[model samples]
Target: MSESTTDAATTASDDDAVAAASSSPGLSRRGLLGLALGGGVAGLAVGVGAGVAGGVALGRARAAEEAQTAYDFFGAHQAGITTPVQEHLHFASFDMMPRTDRDDLISLLQDWSYAASRITQGLEVSATGAVGGDAEEPPDDTGEAQGLPAAGLTITIGFGPSLFENEDGDRYGIADRRPQALERLPPFVGDDLDPAHSQGDLCIQACADDPQVAVHAIRNLSRIAFGRARLRWSQLGFGKTSRTTSAQATPRNLFGFKDGTANILADDAKALEQNVWVAVSDEPGWMAGGSYLVARKIAMLIETWDRVRLSEQDAIIGREKGSGAPLSGGDEFTEPKFSGTAIDANSHVRLAHPDQNDGIRILRRGFNYVDGNNELGRLAAGLFFLSYQRDPQQFIALQKRLSTDLMSEYIRHVGSGIWAVPPGAASGSYVGAGLFA
Candidate 1:
């Protein structure tokens, strides 16, 4: 902790004492109030001490809990990357149906807050006390702790537009996904690409030190939360080909980066809206809170890419052969000049001839999966790419250009799926619901 934080703790201890001095039996309330108001001992010293103890306990508790849940949230020691196994799993939401009895759903949804607290990881921000649930008890309103993740594992629950409305416009949640998809999807199943966590339309992601432990915990959570054993997507990662995937559990993106950079962080709010929010917003009352486009592409051919020359490969991706930077370059964010396009006639970008002016940019979040050994006795894996946008056409534009781009020589796409990430639930509710309404 910083000196400033330590100093603050010391100061609060005096406040807590002053506040508690008045009442002995009811002092806990007085102490808490004083801390919040005067930055008292509870708020400052005792609070800081409590926080540390709490955080450590929370972390340990999460680890224990995850031992039972599948899909480890713990950090693995093998590769260079550092992220809870659960954190690496990607998530998005779609629309669903709302409850006729709003209060009941809210109560049950609020019960989920405890579960949320048990699994959310590294949550930096809280979405605001807008969370409504559990009429028996209200959820605590605080900074990052407002929801869960205090424990090692983390939970990310998404809602469709229907979450905000009742038959008369009350707040409640709903479970939803495309109708045709429900039958094929299991309640909680391992993904073809990522076998760590159980997959759900609205996933409760988790992670822990042990993979078996994590998955076990997750499986239990599935039974408790949804009341069903499980039903998940049959295949979750790269579409099957002659190659193998994650049988031994190694991680890599389709591009073959030792670690592919993630675009989860945007430049600003505008970037968030541009990069993630869908353009269409008029809810037909029934579809009121839904989103419009999900661009899913199973990045095929990274296996073939693993076999190419360093120089030949670098020219295609237009980044440092190893650094994952611009060909003309700087770091990941630097701009590359198209002027360097002539460096190699057979280069990937040269043949693709992408220009900042004409070339479209689509945000990318992808990871590589090392299936089993390939024909060469080497691990075979490719990219699992997902992008969200107001319009998927932009992604299509990039693909059209890439069709003839030099990168195509090394990459081959095998599967594609798309769906809209329905809009967030209205104030005082979580998302998903509308399909059944």
Candidate 2:
């Protein structure tokens, strides 16, 4: 939630606040008096400068709402991977533009980190976020990449500036990632979503034990950042994806049979480079800590997918059982190419198509999800695909090509979220510490 949007929330009417507090025994007389005084002062201030200043603050807050989600790599996310997570809460977010600051917006975003330091519980592993494989790499024994249970849950927020906040002023300027872009997504049914989200100077991400807690943290985080700007636009989700669960049900999306198996795995350069390469730290330069961008819709259909014969399902994804690999051979991170086209007319890449040069190759940080409950009876639930590309065009091209993937039969396109992850930084430094240059 951005400051502007949260400001738009309905507060108890002044009349109501006073009357209710006076009548109900919940709030003490002193507390009620303080509340009314604060409201009156705020109302007077808003009424007075409610034009230019208010507009700019709202604009600043709204500008922060561009949705850029990406999951953290093993080193930075999920401590003790040695222990299987009964449920994992992973969502990837990155800024569309990493270094966007019209004026002091950068400073405000930085300040948010300082203040946020007070509420968190975890060790943060920051890596330089440059992509494009700078001509160097981190030391093989750098120790910058292992044993992270001590690291803790962190809020990794990225910023994107080039994306439109609002084409016009006043009404829409307060939203980032212009609401206009949302029109492109296949309708997900709900109509209440804000067409555009412009909030905060920086995007805020919070994850924890419960999915709901993540949402709660996001809403409260506004107060810290809102001290300087407004909260206008934002979105939130909770918990690790369903596929990470032991549920076995592993619901597929609009497509079917365990989508998104090819990308995820333990860290190994040779194993994943064909898919996406993890940035190797080069000790102390731009390449210190960076990652590649991997994005794909890789759709799925739950109803039909669950019913398909296991053999057919394994073929769609090259993996033996969707542990995420190739039918030709190897487990999740093993080096198994979509090779051997002679055996099957449709190779895994022939089915998925990302291996073809024209398609985009982003670093994939996707996870599965299930919304609504038993009473509500879950609707569609599948991979919430996230990719971090040095350039958006790369990922966009990949999405276009995947339209032909065989998996499309089981998956229906819905809910598209994008984010740009900034290069990593030492814990004390702010998220976009390097981009200003």
Candidate 3:
């Protein structure tokens, strides 16, 4: 419950003071429950009136407990990566303004980190947030999420390859420190990527149970960016396609098949260490505890897919639609039997399975998205695929293998990007500060 964090505007030695100054008083479940039981003497004094008050307090405490699903902003690794996937996502990419210097970059990070720490705790971007600021000035917060709980919100920031070096030529002077595996992903077999949505210098992944809370995080953070960084392209997603904990039931994609059944869970630290977190022995030591992020905007042809025969649909996905079990038999978690015709030779499950890919695995954290209707009256909907791994090659290999998947006939890879997710910020410091160190 300590929830230690930092202040973006100041880097003093007293981290507790800085955190207290930035954070609002959180109404935790324990605190509220204690409040319900604390009015003992006063309750006895009022007799029946006290009983009525106690009932109201107990009810409020239960509601607050259900709403208070918070995570710390400061840790060994950034939250949201392995955190149980949230119900909604507001993923945004940003580019540092032209002619920005190293100091500008550092200051921007400091400010972002400070704001993230507060907002993730269900507080505002600053102490004078929303209605607390001067009447004449714009409030630090956008105010949409006022009176809301944390709802398990998490804000994760990543550094795109362009941030280290770009067409502008080492704008921040740390070009040599760029990770070898942190380059733009090579063109895939059938990528119709839009230049506008493809890449950026930075990416922020904000997720929460409440759509408004997720949107509020990005809205306020984008506002804070102001002159330092500009929004490139953003995505709003719902119905997570993957879950990071065993407690969560596997969610389905737009195509209606259970997705991420074999996903890496938060409890699997061994798999994470082996396949997700970058090791200290790896190159570019600044990213030792960090991971690589790959995002792909896949437009699913649900209309076309919907018309296919049920048998054909099952064949394409290599799983039973109802139970999510592999065609080879057994329940959802059954190791797929690819040896027989039960599973198609070119089925999605077969091709993307780790058994066929040399044990290569990436932790998936994707979500389903819809961009309204297109001119043809078709829903511009798709799967926003997000995966994190120790190296970018893990994604590249799996994607290359899936190029031949039967499901590929109904999906198109549009927006794509790769970013280096630095480790978490320590107390009293901003994220990615070690890059400057």
Candidate 4:
């Protein structure tokens, strides 16, 4: 997870940290060293006491280890798109409040970027946010994540089509700058989309290994938005369904089968350039290094799916139940043989394969979600499908082809959104800063 996206120096440090943490015998000595590296000395000097040095060192050492999982919030591209998938996700959508103008929009993005930078580093939204502020006034931070480590948090922000213009017209004076592909997704064949959960003027995706940390990031950012933007809808998800690096194991969705086996990994720079990141030479130069994000809230009919026979399930997925190998093939990572009837033509694997889609590919970062039981006592659970592509047409074409997918009978697309995620902010700038430039 650490090797592909980061610099060589960062990778080497991560390896050493992992090695030290794994060696049981060197734990104590290494813990103390890690503590010092992680800022434990300040605590000791501030009267933590020499007597409890060992205990304090151990605690900080664990925190330092967690820090190894952290990714820089400001980078060549947004962190969450290609960063290692975390175990939890808190995705939110927002709409600009009525009559809000260009300044409000710009300030909101600036505030969100500032807060995200601190939160990803395991700090409060501001240095004096949670508790350091005046006792008489409300705290800038919500305080739920007080003592927690960063836990690999990444907060990615994006702009929906409505941000540039809406029914009233160019609200932010950037309608001319909007990419041609940035528009509401056309209704798909089997879509049962709910308007309440569909589009937004902005979106924030907060992911972390710890649920509280993830929630906290969104909560505080939501607070910062205040009258500028209001939350449209949000979803909490867990059990990541995709992997961005080979070091990660392919995760399973709510369904029993493995998912995203052929996803674009971070190490595949060529594939990323071709299918994921936008180039400066592309139509919208502001979106260079960025990607289009499509989010679908697919609701699964658990009771029906549970009753399907095991053999039929395998046939629908085009893979073995025990191992994720292709029906015609070897192990999980083996290239699937799709030429013959060995794999069903209508199977998900066959239809969604790159070969079937004109060699097109996408980077997936999906998660499984359970929203408790419905009124009929049925489980309300499904996959929150998220994919980043260089262009919106990549997803539109894929979905058009999957309209005939056999598995569609057991699932419904209830929510949909598409956002043009801007490239990472340089120091002292905000996400989407180029739109106003």
By lDDT, who's the top model here? Answer: 3
Please provide, for model 1 over 100-209, each residue's C-alpha lDDT reduced to its tens digit, 9 standing for 90 to 100: 25443333333333323222322211121214434343222222233222233333333322333324454333333232211222211112333222223343323333
Q: Which residue pairs collide in model 4, if any?
A: none
Candidate 4 lDDT over 369-419, as tens digits, reads: 888899999998999999999999999999988978888899999999999
Score every model by TM-score. Answer: 0.48, 0.50, 0.87, 0.87
* Candidate 1 lowest-lDDT run of ten: 1-10
**What's the TM for model 3?**
0.87
- Please give the RMSD of candidate 3 to the true structure: 10.9
lDDT of each: 0.34, 0.36, 0.80, 0.79
Q: Could you arrange the candidates by TM-score from highest to lowest?
A: 3, 4, 2, 1
Backbone clashes per model, in order?
61, 74, 0, 0
Can you write out model 3's per-residue Cα lDDT over 55-90, one digit (the tens) per residue? 577777754553577776777788888887887888
Query: Where in model 4 is the C-alpha error above 4 Å?
Result: 1-68
The Cα RMSD of model 1 versus the native structure comes to 15.1
lDDT of 4 at 363: 91
Q: Between candidates 2 and 4, which one is better according to lDDT?
A: 4
* Selected candidate, larger TM-score, 2 vs 3: 3
